[model samples]
Target: MAVDAAPRRTGTGTNQEGVRRHNLATMLRQVHLGGPTSRAELTAAMGLNRSTIGGLVTELTSLGLVTVGSAPAGPGGARGAGRPSPRVALAEAGPYVVAVDLGVDQVVVARVGLGGVVHERVRGPVDPDAEAWQVGAGIAALVRRVVRGAPAGAPLAGIGMSVPGLVRRSDGLVRLAPNLGWVDVSPGSIILAALGVDVPVSLANDADLGALAEHGRGVGVGIDDLIFVSGNVGVGAGVVAGGQRLEGSGGYAGEVGHMVFDPEGRDCHCGSRGCFETEVGAHAIAEAIGCPVDAVGSLGDVLDGYATPPPALHRIGHQLGEGLSGIVNAFNPQVVVLGGYFRALHRLVPGDIAAGVHARTLPAPLESLVLSQPGLGADSILLGAAEMALEPLLADPVAGLQASLAEASSRLAG
Candidate 1:
């Protein structure tokens, strides 16, 4: 007889001490995702005995990762059936990660804590025409300012940066960022040198991080296969398949902007003709709407009229959908989330965009596909970066925390 099996979860293997660490991370993640939960619920969810859950909760409480509080009274104004199980939640002032979203025209830095909370943030503009090193210096300065304001004694988990271009996953290097006019820049080292810190750094594409943020904490949560498309000064995508981010060979899988859509279209900075970016990029939209390339703010103001978008905006939406249809046909994703300018445009001219996509793509994939806007809005990339920084800690909380503390101690002594 032919039999079917259930899907297996990944990254659950552990060493002798790995069990303890993994259990701690699991508990923390549960509370982080579902909000405050009762101890009994956690025990049931984890499939662990009550004693083990108690011990893990004690350790977490001692480390300031979570706090245990009395459960609320039942509907009848009396405590629940048995002894009321204490609720657990992430500590409000615990450790945090520094998240940087380096866009073409601005830099945003945020302090994000466990459970995907943004405590504080700062933003400043940058010159896209400036030298790569100059931009790096500006970003480093902004990062320093944000770090300085972080809670005292909070363990610095790591730094996660989201760049508006292609990044090599092996090393946090910017291979090319056409929108920012940067090439072959090592932003991680530049920022680390500027800060004189020994913290770990993770760098990735802005759209990639946005996809991750949406999948883990936003609208796409629990959706394994989806594509996040971001339109700003550039167009790009982050693809997730089988519950994992798909970074192709050399980590350039999601450069959807470079896909040629028109053979006789405008020239792209990537040295290509008629690329999708040349059709729907912010600069392209601005040009179509009779605005300067730097007049994105004014362009946004004009496009904010969703009830009656201009002809130029409608054309942009059509072009965007045309480009996205190919993606839908090829990847057949469960959903396609729009971010950055695309989100706004989608809100304004969803019908035109849908018409374009429906006209181009095959019926099956398009029928099951969901087109939506980002839930986190402007915060998606930053929150995703924070998630990158917090990943290691979540995988092995005890070891990660110990290493961070030791590094902090060493820095102080030196």
Candidate 2:
């Protein structure tokens, strides 16, 4: 996990004090996620004792991370039950996150609060062929606009950029992005330099972010193992196994678009023959119907045309199903989410794909399985990007606490 630089240090605190604050922040975050809970509930959720929860709540209250609310009377809300304990909720004005989705055609910028509220977002066209520098400039402009619009003193913790294609996480360098025609572009550094701030920036593939977003708040909630397939100009999948995002060895775990669907059908920009993108991807469907991919007028028209099962559509759907079946058997995920441009095509392909997976998979994993379009469509990726940016804050309470302390220290030194 990554986080923005530590905030200025507050009055020379000892290491023990820092550790105490970190524990308190962690406890508060747990309470906020579980929702208005009592000290007992917090202890249960954090695996800590009642005394620890009490001390943590006191610290969080002083720092304005947690607030006391009306407590529940336990079990039946009976008046004769034991005294109700104070319930806790996150404070409204905690630090914020900036989520940016850098798409092939547009950029989506969102200012999100700790509570998952999208306080602001801007979506519009961006130069598809813009140089990496230009793209960073556009993002910086959007980020500054968001910062300006935030409540007068809102603290921006960090920025998360959801990109399309392979990203090298080590330095936030984009190793390759065929769609964007970018190579070795350091988007994080560019954005930080442009914004004149050194906030920690995280970059991940769009589909990966989409999976996080969907799992965090959308259709995949409560599902620990799943796959999210995003179909647009290209097709990609994000895998979550055992409740963790799978970035793979090189962080390119989900390049479904490059899967070989046709070895002799057509040429792909990826220099592969009959890749998955040639058959079921948005561009492939559009080309199959002899229309502009963007002009195909939505997935409905494409799938509707598939009812006749033309040579191209039938073969494409069948092959796409073939690829998906392999995934079902290998992972036996609880569910599979199909989103992006393919969402509109769900009505037409779900039955076929389900049948394919059922036919190919063992009986047990197939018995209670589910495969469908993500309940969230285009917005899924955007929301996912926002979630990615907020991930560090959620996963690492110590880093955020350290940042606040560093900020306090800087102010005093000045």
Per-residue alpha-carbon lDDT of model 2 for 1-414, expressed as tens digits? 111222233477546656565566566556544556777766666666678668778877766566787765546756545666677877676667788887777788987776667788887567776888998888888887766666544456678888888987566778988878988888898987877666767888888888887777778878898889887567888898898999888788888888786588778888888887777776777777676655432444455555544456555566667777767777778888887666656565556666656666788877767886786667777777766666666555556644533342222123
Against the reference, the lDDT scores of all candidates come to 0.82, 0.71
Model 1 regions lying over 4 Å from their true place: 1-15, 72-84, 297-302, 305-307, 405-414
Best-matching candidate per TM-score: 1
Model 2 local distance difference test score: 0.71
User: Which residue pairs does candidate 1 place in steric collision?
Assistant: none
Q: In angstroms, give how far residue 154 of model 1 lies from its true place.
A: 0.6
Give residue 120's lDDT in candidate 2 (0 to 100).
Answer: 84
- Candidate 2 residues lying further than 4 Å off, grouped into runs, are 1-22, 71-85, 289-291, 294-317, 362-364, 375-377, 404-414
Error of 2 at 246 (Å): 1.7
Please report, as a residue range, the 10-residue window in candidate 2 with the lowest summed lDDT: 1-10
* Native-to-model Cα distance after best TM-score fit, residue 351 in candidate 2, in Å: 1.7
Highest lDDT: give the candidate number.
1
RMSD of each: 4.1, 6.2
